[model samples]
Target: MNLGPLEIGLIILAVLLLFGYKKLPDASRSLGRSMRIFKGEMKGMKDDDVRGKEEATTVRGQLAPPAAASPTAGAPDYEAEALAAEARAAEARAAEARARADAARSGVTPADGTR
Candidate 1:
């Protein structure tokens, strides 16, 4: 059914009357938001359908993600690396503390390196 200008005007008039001028802006904003949400959902469904068609050849259970492409992707010792880095940082801090103590005993600031 074709909605002419008259039909559109009647619909607008009805809506305006149903929701008074004070509430018209809020009602229109909600209507616009709902329409936008509906549109996004429809687009998502279409994208999902396209994705399904693209992966139709692969079985759901047997599908494995593609192997890592980077050279270091297989180095799985992350915790060891983190621990080693933490140890190095601790050693540096210890050295700095010792320097500060020696400077304090000699009545010099380690930062100035002067007597």
Candidate 2:
């Protein structure tokens, strides 16, 4: 399957005889252009696939609230949910800090939960 120097030289000679040196540059340039176009199209297809997936995710997120909610109400408010989650996390952190401080003052090891 591997071409040695002799095989490569023979192939080159055949090409030069068939197309001539004058046309070789033009043929190579056209081949290069075709390859570039093919590569560009492949890249474009991949980008389109990624874009399609993102759009589907967005559409699903938009549609999910109405399906999950009762018919009487509108879509769920995700922003408020996110904000409430953040607030809960902040409160937990504050509570942990207070516990550590309390343990330090009472001479308790926080890890052992002793006073």
Candidate 3:
């Protein structure tokens, strides 16, 4: 709840009577000074928070990310692998043909059926 004008006036009157007019000015001045100091401290903290956030963002920006590319970009193609496999198959067939020729020259006939 908030104090209405009546309550506030009563409080002021009480203070005035307790600490007469002579001391009231000094008391109010000190209170104002303290409030200003407190306000300044709060402002400083807010500025520090802003500065910290700015610095963090700058640091994050400095750390560059890897470049983006398509999934098939800068990658080996399977077509090349298929061609290499075909070449290997051809080499295997040639070797098998040479083996058969050597066996025929040595008289190893198919009718032998030797294990």
- Which candidate tops lDDT? 2
Clashes of each: 0, 0, 0
Full candidate order by lDDT, most accurate first: 2, 1, 3
Question: Mind sharing the TM-score for model 2?
Answer: 0.52
What digit string (tens of lDDT, one per residue) describes model 1 on residues 1-115? 9999999999989988888889987666656655654565567558655655444433344443334534366754434544565566557656755665576556575685522
RMSD of each: 23.7, 23.2, 40.0
Query: What would the TM-scores of all predictions be?
Result: 0.40, 0.52, 0.44
**Rank ordering of all candidates by TM-score, starting from the highest:** 2, 3, 1
* lDDT at residue 91 of model 1 (Cα atoms): 78
* Number of colliding residue pairs in model 1: 0
* Stretches of model 1 off by over 4 angstroms after superposition: 1-13, 59-115
TM-score of 1: 0.40
Estimate, for each residue in 86-107, the C-alpha lDDT of model 2 and write its tens digit: 5665576567656755765465
- Of the candidates numbered 1 and 3, which has the greater TM-score value? 3
Worst 10 residues of 2 by lDDT: 63-72
Give me the runs in candidate 3 sitting further than 4 Å from their true place: 1-9, 60-115
lDDT value for model 2: 0.63
Q: What C-alpha lDDT, on a 0 to 100 scale, does residue 54 get in candidate 2?
A: 60
